[model samples]
Target: MKNNLLLGITGSIAASKTEKLYNSLKDQYNIKFVSTSEGLKYLDDNFKINNNIISSWDNETGSPHIELSRWADKFVIYPATANFISKLNNGISDDILSATALMYKDSIYIAPAMHEEMYINEVTQENILELSKKHIFCGPKYGKLDIGDEGLGRLLEPDELINIIEKTKEKIIVTSGPTFENIDLVRGITNSSSGKQGRAIAYELLSKGYDVIYIHSDLINPVPHARNITYSSSDDLYQSILKNIKDVKKIYMTSAVSDFIPEKFNKKMSRESGELFLKLSPNIDIIKTIKSQYKDIKVIGFSAQLDDNLNFEKINTKNCDYLVINNLKDNYFGSDNNKIFIIDRDKLIYESSVENKNIIAQHIVKNTTS
Candidate 1:
């Protein structure tokens, strides 16, 4: 399905670039060209947008500002002028573009374009930072400026804008780090899993415009663009996945969930008081359970083993769409590097040389998705 894209153009010398931007994106998206009154001045008289422009609050159909705000899947302001940025950050909606921008409910793509001085001014910089919390930025690449002066505040090429706004987006789940199993108030069990591989996968997915939910341990820092959820125990991880399971297209089970859980002690155990005895019980088979319940959801299970021997039974038992094997003997427990074997039901789909986790992550995504 084509994405519903709303392009909000504003007063800037770079506004003239929207003519080419429109043609490149017209077919990929169901777009509406909305311009501030000043932006229209930069456009040619015979430009296609002259007939399609929606600049007023009211039209034959009713309130366009309200309609367009809700209609768009993504709102992009190409060549957003400094005045437009200030108006939006300050919540002034005297014009249609400002009104719709204030009313937008989803993530917006703001491509700022102006003179270098205006772009670097403390007020404009602060406004951009304030909006960065909820909005995505394309670029005012460092290149030629409007008045034959060059620094920053140059608009990105039309093709670059189209590339960013047209990419297909889907929600994915990535579980990372080691899951802890509590034994006492002061003691718990967790593996040396570093969470680097999962973080790398989430990073790669985010760069490709996927809506990534990174369910990880606090052992690793959160990926900047991903929605992060931290889990401490196997149950915590299970509940986190369950909470975000809806609408997710894929699940990457990369966290090292404890195999055996220790009986919980209400109070911290003391070494000087008595000899300690810990009783172990089997933990939840998270992957197996999720696959059994949501047979339609694609679940990729990760297993850390002591050897490189192929294990098809585990994959068959879990009913995973794909299985990734990590060899612990290679010292991958807490390392930034990894060597992996990707498998389907019975065949090895891909095997990688020991490499950095980021490169391994890219290969993992490439092969599994293909």
Candidate 2:
């Protein structure tokens, strides 16, 4: 039997997006729609009706709100407005949606959407925090919003919401982007990595219902789903991982951490323009450090090499479970396509053809888990 999913729509500009959300998940589950009185105004009139579309509590049937609450296996409020959140937090049961929320004891998911200012309001934050104790809070992600403004409070896409609702409790850590090593106030040493592959991997894990803790540099592309910890230098990345890896089951060390850093850093930009020399010092090997302490955690490391063939004998596993080797000759630094060899401690396991980073990410997850 298909799981019954009751989608509760609230008044927000993002209410219009529910049509797309419905279309995306209609086949996967048995869906029923309900909208608040104000929510109904923003929703498209042409939205296809499936089982029941309830706008009000008034009905010939005895207590439609209670009946619907009991019918659903899961209840979701997408594009949940500030007003709706406030009502839900305050135990307001005047409306059918709030009534259903009060009655339902099982899983309830909320995806909030509103103006950035409204979202950041103290009262709104308090309400959301209280509600989060029970219900699953998906996102009001940072992105473009309805009024041509950009910040947090944009509704997460339908696919992202589906991932959140179906996600598992297994914790995974993903490190991404190039770690900067400051030489002077204005200059730094970093790699050409754009962090696209790492972000793709994080999203892939999320889509498969894995809880991801993403530790990334500020310069990289943003990943919307996971809890993020930002790092600037290699030491910062190393410390962040050590601090956050308490219960992590798996680690994806994808960041291109600088191998060397200037022994002495100039506090300000250098003014003397004579021939300048820098003493370089080797940074800590993050993968080796993590595996040394947590031997049981499955670790995945990335090697960007110049050679097409990966010499497994020369590569240091350092207790890493999987190694993803890609050739710099293939020009995968900032590109969408990637060709990689998946290697284990023993031998070459799988070699992937040049394909979309997202597809490669899917393969990596599948192979690693299998």
Candidate 3:
């Protein structure tokens, strides 16, 4: 079925590209162009808007904005100005895009484009938070501004927008981090892990253009830009993963799952003083479950052992397609330096210590693709 989309244009240098994008998208789907006052300034007087177009003019006979919002399966705004984004966040209804966006009941997305400073401002961040809270999708991968300033504030390209709209139907899922098995509210059985390896791998997958669903347990640094489901205990993590596994293509069990959990949880620990007796039980084996049931999905697991000699074949038998064996002698858990021996089915790839996760992530992606 041909999709109906409302493309909201806001003021930015990149707003000029919207007409070309509209033309391109028109070939595959229905296009309705709505522009902010600042955006219309750059456009022609009689801007060749066809019957498919929806102008924000309240004086127009039909309620074009409302009708267009209803008609659209998805609404997206490209070259979203900082001022326009702020208005949308605050429900100001000062412009057509913001007003129609407030009315739109369907999936909505925005592509923000502005100067580096404007994009990084607290107000802009708050606007982004507002949009996120509404469950509105955004971003094609974080990039710098069009003005060549470095940072995350770039409007997504036409191809990227189209790709996300299309591929969202069948997206790849990735999970990352360590799983703790709780004893009580205060105590838990956890692994010697910081979730660095898994986070790095997830980012690697994302960079290679894969949609990621990261179940984070122990995050140590700048969090990966993926759909995150946080859990503190192994049981919680286990259930969450099991629930989402049906849609997953590949299950990367990079989380250092706790093997033991307290069988007897003490709810009234403070009330009872003295020796406490706690029984322990094994947590769910995530990799094994995926391997047994979800045979169609590729399973990648990680093992951070204390072994000094890099014997990858022995480590590969741990039942993961790719097993990242990082020697504890180098402090692989929480430390920045990582020396890993990647064990694949037929080959072993060795990596030296590196500081940047991006570099390490690229290596992982290369191996996965190869």
Candidate 4:
């Protein structure tokens, strides 16, 4: 089914950019535009304006809010005012757009635009925290603002907004980042992973025409604009992998899946200079399990080593169909460029000395497809 996007525009000078966003998504999805009272003032008269283009919640007959809510696959509010956000948090419905948002049944995303000070206000922060709990607030990302000051509190780029809409599909599961096995609530075991490589790979795969389902471990920055399932421990990671493996055609085991996990965990634990004994146990081998059980599915494993100590031939012969061997001595985890040896069927079919992870991913996908 074609996606239906309900664009809610509120009072912000950036509301003028709605035309650009509308045009970008017009060919891709069924889009309905809604403008708030304050928003209507900012739009030029040359552009089409009508009640159809705007939404109202209190209309008794058809109940426009509920109708639109049922009509839309996703709801996106651009230039979401601080007031609108606060009302949303408190379930206040003074305006049609905000009312529709409060009543909408589908996934909701908002992009805030305001003054830097307002953006940083404690109340704004609290409302944003509440919005984040239930909705995706993309950015007041750093850029030239509507006001001359120019610090944060600017609307996100149009393409970014479109990407966010495109990425909300329920299919495609991508697992990224490093899983840390917690010894206690305060202390844990993690690896030298920035989650950049996995995130890049996941996004690259998505761009190459695959649905992405991301199981995030240590989501350092803006989590990749994709469906995400957060996991911390190797056990949780393994469970997520197994749950997704049946539906996923390819398993990119790019996460730094911990080899060992603390055998026990304490909820109320501290780090107050106490010698605590930790018993480590092997984590479930996700790739091998997927390779063995789901023989038809492709399993790709990451081999990260400090040096060239691992046997590539033997590793290749193992259950995983392919292994991307990366040497961490060169700081492969966080670096944008990496040297990877592609092991397939006990042979080095392709090798990259030093190249960006994106190019490497393209190469890997090409090889996998062929």
Candidate 5:
């Protein structure tokens, strides 16, 4: 049976974000909703009582708060209001949500949402500090608020909150974007990778609780939850990965590293000069290098083969646990949707139809993670 998640919705304008949150997590957990009276007002009639919603303290047999607390594996209060925060801090159990929160012994994840003044108020700050020592507090992020004023006290996005609630200590290293191999200060060779797929995978991993160390070229999009390290050249990215791989358990090699680099350095190249001659040398394989040293760590490699004829044998030589293959003919570079084939040493494991990168990311993580 799936674990039960008791989602507590409080009175805040950001309460509306819970619908998205529910939709995202419903498949992974058995979710039950419990909303405050004010929270109930914001939700439509679709939030039916007894079936999924638990609004009141009234129960036929015994205390609903106690029973619900016992049933829940984890409790999360999204858009936890200033009023509720104060009530929780003061140990006031006047309502069903507060009463249930008081009895819940496991970690209670809270995402605060309120006006800027109310969030920064001394009382709320103190209450937050008190709660932080025992429970997890996601965010009252800085952004536009419900009252047309923009500042701190905006509820965190649903994905951010989910990442916090589901977070684990395990480390994952994700490398993205194209690595440049400079022939001169002005000229270089690089691949066409835009790093969209890698960024999406990093976000998906973060949402599922992995602590991600993201290494990428400066051009790639950055995920909010990752510890991002920027690199320009293939050598720079290789060194960065080695520096941060001490405790990492998994490495996603999504960066399109240059296969060859200039054998000799040139200060500058003139276009007016006669045809330039240069010697090129093959670059070190980053994934193979890491896997050779850290055999226990799982390595997932990405191959962008221009030809439809994929050499699975060459991929197997890298010693990666999984290889994600994409053909250049499919126009994967910089595109939001992708068609991918995931294979192991023996055979292909999963083949995805052209779909959004986020969906592809979800499948990759689901297949890779135990």
Candidate 6:
């Protein structure tokens, strides 16, 4: 049987593209469309999909919202407007699309289109972050918007949407945040990693239908829809990996693991004893150990350093299939934006300009995985 697909169209200029999207999916899917009243204005007159389209509550009988929400195997909101997204998040079921979305419990794929400024507004972003927990999003790709203005609010192309909605799914592990080595009960050493990058990776993976196990430190929040595991020290992280390694296909080792662990004292050190000497020992080499023990599992290592050059030797030493590098010289620690380089053991494969961590993640995952 063909997959059931419900495409919700809202009031955006990109709704004109809905006919193309419908025609693209008709062969592979049992296609149905539900458009907000305003959405009907922008749709092309050439649309045969009007026969299958539901425009208002009165047009359909006996709770169409509930029926549509339950019927679709894949539910998408294409050309989702900022207003519609806000309404969906706040439970304002004032229209057909909003009502159906509110009734839909499964992950809804949202493709947004608006001005770049509105797309990037703090309110919209907050709504997106919150809703992403139980939904998927393809793009507002960077391109021409309405009125010839160009930025990142363009709707994704038909093929891009098809690829995302039908992409092969996999199980993978993603580690985030900084590992802390406790010196005593009161003091510890850790890096400045805020876990934003890893969160972005997990979010992207979730959107692509990857089953993600997210290992993160308590200092950062967890990615929704991922199986979140919290770790403190490097040893704790390694143990978490060991416990969850069964049937895992890949590991994105993005956490900033502490290189050295301080010797722990059973008793808390008083301020008077601060002058005493201490010993530091090298922490566990997690990636190397995992690669050695489970040779089939692909481990993607991450390195953050002040040097601009890619270190092929470091990647070789760790046995990572790909090493993602971020230059700390740019002073981007804990920031939501990043520039990155992806290197194999032999040479650099990809480099990204400074952008949001989510965008950076898409480049990294696409290159390394492909």
Scored by lDDT, the top model is: 6
Pairs that collide in candidate 2 are none
- Model 3 steric clash pairs: 180-234
Which pairs clash (backbone N, Cα, C closer than 3 Å) in model 4?
A: 172-212, 172-213, 173-213, 174-213, 174-214
Off by over 4 Å in 5: 1-167, 264-266, 308-310
Residue-level lDDT for 268 in candidate 2? 64
Q: Give the per-residue Cα lDDT of candidate 3 at 232.
A: 69
Q: Write the residue-wise lDDT of candidate 4 on 14-96 in tens digits.
A: 98888888878878789887778888878777665432567454434667777777888878888789888888889987767
Clashes of each: 0, 0, 1, 5, 0, 0
Ten-residue stretch with the least lDDT total in model 5: 43-52
Global lDDT scores for all candidate models? 0.83, 0.82, 0.66, 0.72, 0.82, 0.84
lDDT ranking from best candidate downward: 6, 1, 2, 5, 4, 3
Sum up the clashes in candidate 3: 1
lDDT of 6 by residue, 19-55 (tens): 8888888998998889888888898775734456787
Please state the error at residue 352 of candidate 4 in Å.
8.4
Q: Write the per-residue lDDT of candidate 3 for residues 137-197, one digit (tens) a residue.
A: 4452334556575444556677666665666533445555666665676666666677766
Model 4 lDDT, residue 232, Cα: 80
TM-score of each: 0.64, 0.67, 0.71, 0.59, 0.63, 0.79
Candidate 5 clash pair list: none
Provide the lDDT at 132 for model 1.
67
**Which residue runs of candidate 3 sit more than 4 Å off their true CA positions?**
1-3, 12-20, 38-63, 71-73, 81-90, 112-136, 146-153, 168-171, 183-185, 189-212, 218-228, 259-285, 304-311, 324-343, 349-355, 358-370
Better of 2 and 4 by lDDT: 2
Residues 102-127, candidate 1: write the lDDT tens digits.
99988898888888799778888778
Q: Which portions of model 2 miss their true places by more than 4 Å?
A: 1-5, 9-32, 35-50, 56-74, 77-167, 314-317
**TM-score leader:** 6
Error of 1 at 33 (Å): 14
Q: Ten-residue segment with the worst summed lDDT in candidate 6?
A: 44-53
Clashes of 1: 0
